[model samples]
Target: MGVIMEMNFNEDDKYLLAKKKVEKIKGFYGNLTSFILVNIILIFINLYTSPNHLWFYWPLMWWGFGVVIHGLKVFEVFPSFGKDWEEKKIKELMEKEKNNKNKWQ
Candidate 1:
């Protein structure tokens, strides 16, 4: 036989979780917009100022790496630290705390 567990959450809790997810998506979009706009400006400046030197790519590449990681995290593409990991960690910690309290009592 297999064991099944149900997790119940109230309406407010569901709403708050949904709102937090939306906020994360919104933040990712904001980061992407800033990355595009700033990189555009940097490219223009590099082209106009140095032309042959081409140093704009330095910041673009590094900042782009950060943006990519941020997108991956926000979209939950990386499972290591995603929703399941968070819930599991939370439960684990709660269980540990309960055990400690019981030991003390």
Candidate 2:
């Protein structure tokens, strides 16, 4: 009936959304697991060669910040700029293009 994509969520869509959320959380867990595993290996490697210089901590801290943010996003601890924002932006662009087209014609 309408040309524009529907912005509403039906009951079926909720299941898809929940599945996507679970996937995100599962991905974060995988990321965290890799982080821990690799860091443990690096820690031993660092100690084996140069016990004084601890370079592994450098990546540990920086990448750990990224992991934290990823977790926050997955858990929705931080609000996302979501579908509403995307839809509004799309509408704005379409209006701009329409106005430009009108001018050309």
Candidate 3:
């Protein structure tokens, strides 16, 4: 037979978790805003300085990829690193700690 355990979060834990989530969202927005503003300036510079040979697309494409990944991670759009994965990892760590404590006792 296997023993089952349940984890519960108190009010403080809930509040902290919510705060962390909000911070991640804010950070993502900040990153996205920077990406847009910087790319706009790059586009302008490329056009004004060297319109004949364009090169702004290079940074735009690479930075856009990073922004997309940041957004996906913040929004939990990727299943591998989403909420389920976090919870599972937390539980696994807690179980490991419990076993170690038991062995010492």
Task: Give per-candidate clash totals.
Answer: 0, 0, 0
Measured against the true structure, the TM-scores of the candidates, in listed sequence, are 0.92, 0.69, 0.87
| Model 3 misplaced regions, further than 4 Å | 1-4
Quality of model 3 by C-alpha lDDT = 0.89
C-alpha displacement of 28 in model 3, angstroms? 0.5
Question: Which candidate should be chosen as best, given TM-score against the real structure?
Answer: 1
Residues 1-105, model 3: lDDT tens digits: 123356688999989989999999999999999999999999999999999999999999999999999999989998789977888777788888888888899
**Candidate 1 local lDDT, 1-105, one digit each (tens):** 122234578999899999999999999999999999999999999999999999999999999999999999999998889987887677777777777888899
Stretches off by above 4 angstroms in model 2 are: 1-8, 80-105
Question: What lDDT does each candidate get?
Answer: 0.89, 0.80, 0.89
Model 1 lDDT, residue 79, Cα: 88
Worst lDDT window (10 residues) for model 1? 1-10
Superposed Cα deviation of residue 43, candidate 2 (Å): 0.7
> Ranking by TM-score, best first?
1, 3, 2
